[model samples]
Target: MELVTHSPGDGVYPPTGDYAHAIEVRGAERLVFLAGTMGLDPSGVPGATLDDQLVLIWSNIRVILASAGMTVDNIVRLTSYLRDASYAGANAKARVEALGGRVVPTTAIVAQTLDSEWLIEIEVTAAS
Candidate 1:
């Protein structure tokens, strides 16, 4: 796989050391776009807190990535929907850490989620 990184001269640098300006992958044989995943456990129980939900969501994403014979590095984009926008930063930080510093995927965090009981939902797009 070929990856591209862009650093615009006029654009401001990223505050966090984790991500690049952008990532591009070309000549992909297959692409996967996963549905929004909630924080439900194996038995369909929701996590008690936002931190717990974040952890579970990350784990689920990891599992899905592995199923496709890919890793977090293969992800190109992510969309996260949160029950509360105020908690987005903290949740994103937890997700990045869970991925072990690989944060190339572009992310969007929305305040309004589909379910009231859910704290967060994450969708991903990957190629390999």
Candidate 2:
């Protein structure tokens, strides 16, 4: 599939951080929509810190992608649910690292999670 990122260089304000204003996916034969995944380890334990949770969440996402013969490059969109807005920077940094700087449409929201221990939950849409 061909991924086209639309970022207006003039007139409109540019997107902040590592994300495109919009993404156009072309010739995609498959679309994978993952449910909201928490930062749980193999034993289903939540991480104590934001960084730790971010690491675990990305690791889980990678495993899920691999199961479908896809990689982080196939990620077209992502939504992050954070316990607090302060975690935004760390979250963005993790996303950049996980996708190797491949920008996609992303949104972050601060919300209360089902489990208080869960500092973050992420859901993604991938196409290939």
Candidate 3:
């Protein structure tokens, strides 16, 4: 599989974070669409802080992707739901770290989560 990120420099503003405006996948045989995931533990406990939650969320995503025979490098798109707009910076930081600075199409929105304890939720699409 091959992945191409598009970030037009003239017609659009540059991406503000470590993400692209769009991604194109070619010759992909498998596609995995993950559910909106929160930073809950095995016993369904949320992390106490944003940093802690970010770590758990990435770890959970890793396990889920592995189960589907994919890795973070296979991620092509991601949508993040943040309880508050202020969480955007931290969320972007965690995403860059998790993906090792690999830019992908990403969107973050300020919205309420199903659970009060969930500060952020992320759903990703991986193709391989």
The numbered model that scores best in lDDT is: 2
Model 2 C-alpha lDDT per residue in residues 1-128, reported as the tens digit of each score: 89999999999999986999899999999999989988999999998899999999999999999999998999999999999999999999999999999899999999999989999999999999
- Off-target runs (Cα >4 Å) in candidate 2 are none
Error of 3 at 103 (Å): 0.4
TM agreement with the true structure for every prediction: 0.84, 0.96, 0.97
Candidate 2 residue-pair clash tally: 0
User: What tens digits encode model 3's per-residue C-alpha lDDT throughout 82-124?
Assistant: 9999999999999999999999999999999988899999999
Which stretches in model 3 have alpha-carbon errors above 4 Å? Answer: none
The residue-level lDDT of candidate 2 at 28 comes to: 100
Tell me the whole-model lDDT of each prediction, alpha carbons only.
0.78, 0.94, 0.93
Clashing pairs counted in every model: 0, 0, 0
lDDT (10s digit) by residue, model 1, range 95-118 = 678667776645656676766778
Arranged by TM-score with the best first, the candidates are 3, 2, 1
Which residue runs does candidate 1 get wrong by more than 4 Å? 11-18
Question: In model 1, what is the error at residue 44, expressed in angstroms?
Answer: 1.7
Error of 1 at 13 (Å): 7.5
Error of 3 at 89 (Å): 0.7
TM-score of structure candidate 2: 0.96
